[model samples]
Target: MLFTSSSSEKEILSIISKQLLLGSTDARHPFRFVNLCTLDGNQPDSRYVVLREFKEDLALFFYTDSRSEKVAQINKNPNAALLFYHPIERCQVKIGGKAQIITNTELIKEHWNNVQTEAKKGYQSVLAPKTAVSQPEEGWVQELKYQSKNFSIIKVRAKQIECLQLDDEGHLRIGFNKKQEVWQSTWLVP
Candidate 1:
């Protein structure tokens, strides 16, 4: 496969219309991530969080404490980069966007009430992610129809997407930009 002609960005983006998190190699198919914001300035200051849902091209879902450091960072810098990888697909997707915090009590309750016990456990981590190295601990958890008002959801509005593929075709880097309310993309050799 070889080509050297300019094409409409939409033509190339058609292959990636589906919202998915794929691997860049063969050993991490399920390892997924979402873009995060931080005030630390280091690229790694960003965390790899499980993406809970993708709501069309307008929004993406993630859960967190309204009091966490990240919440503060988003309040300051809303721009971020979300990365998702799946080893089995030899694919990697990077998203650049602005993060919007959702604070509607009704919406938060709806999402929280549906959360299973295992997932609900995350609420405790907001306090201390690695407090006990090797000892018993004390903490509070939610199991009933209750959630902290601080429980928040972050929605990412994607403005650009970079999808990379590696294989027999060597490596390809494609970028998509939102233009005039439509997506336009371009291919680059990497």
Candidate 2:
């Protein structure tokens, strides 16, 4: 087996840290695109979002339009999940946490300035996301202005982490929970 039955908590966390680093720095990393899941009434809403930032404590950062439907869902319920997978590595990470939205702040301007011109256009949409447009051209903004007001930052502080690694020999699944600034990890069945 690739992993021993006695895998340490530190080792699991280290693996997670490496994956998070790859997600943020490597463009081709599979973890770069994560499925962000949020509650919409009693159902679930999920969408792919690029990973903007990662913190060791399992906090994640992503950008989206302030007027997006996901933002409204998050407002109603802060609980959320970020699911990531890397096919080549045969690894999957599920992070559960509370999402906090940041807008109208200096950080928003900083993030807006950092986004590429092409991507910044997403926030400049004439109408909010999920709005019906009569024509294709009517949906987008032709202006080059990078409006910070419409840029939103989502911060997710992870309360639980589930990581699964599949290999030819065996599959390993681990879970981590944070309490009082300490992390407790345990092995889970695949």
Candidate 3:
């Protein structure tokens, strides 16, 4: 593929949109999982999270337990990062942004409604996440009701996006940052 400055920018955006859309349909898709990074004091914490939703040119959505340490970290410091890699395509994307927890909102409720009962059971645990347990089964109770309070969604408002595409012919890198409420993109050496 030819990589002119203009064409590369367009191709980068196209790839991002395509991969995000693919995540919604293909469970095995590379974009289905993202490495989410949060700060715990001066230390960095990272975990693999499912990519739940992608809003074009806006933000990414993921769900987590409100009692989880990541949620608490986000509440304390909203700054976060997400990294996604499509090995088959040899494309990688890194996003830096601010994260906000959504709970008790219509959006959260709607997300919960869409989840299956079996998955919803995850939020119904009586004990908080990361709690010590003598046995694995003792961690969760056979609850009669789902704990809506524990179900939380995260919205990561992207401020910058860095994408790299590696191909047999050549490699391309592009960076996009929000400036004056508009996205300004530039080509980076890969």
Best by TM-score: 2
* lDDT of candidate model 2 versus the reference: 0.84
Q: What RMSD does each model have against the real structure?
A: 4.9, 1.8, 2.1
lDDT of 1 by residue, 81-184 (tens): 77765466566777788887887888888888866777666674434443444434443433444445556888788899887776674766788888877877
Greater-TM-score candidate between 1 and 2: 2
lDDT of 3 by residue, 1-190 (tens): 3233457576667668778767755779988999999999979999999988888766788989888999999999999999988887778889999999976588888999988889998888888989999999988675648757789999998899888878776788889998877888988898
Q: Which residue pairs collide in model 2, if any?
A: none
lDDT of 2 by residue, 1-190 (tens): 2235466878778877778877887888888999999999989899999999888777889999889999999999999999998787778889999998985588888877889988888888778888887777788654556667788999999999888889767788988998998989888897
Residue 188 lDDT in candidate 2: 88
The best candidate by lDDT is 2
User: RMSD in angstroms, candidate 2?
Assistant: 1.8
Task: Using lDDT, rank the candidates from best to worst.
Answer: 2, 3, 1
> Backbone clashes in each candidate structure, one number apiece?
10, 0, 0
The local lDDT score (0 to 100) that residue 96 gets in candidate 2 is: 93
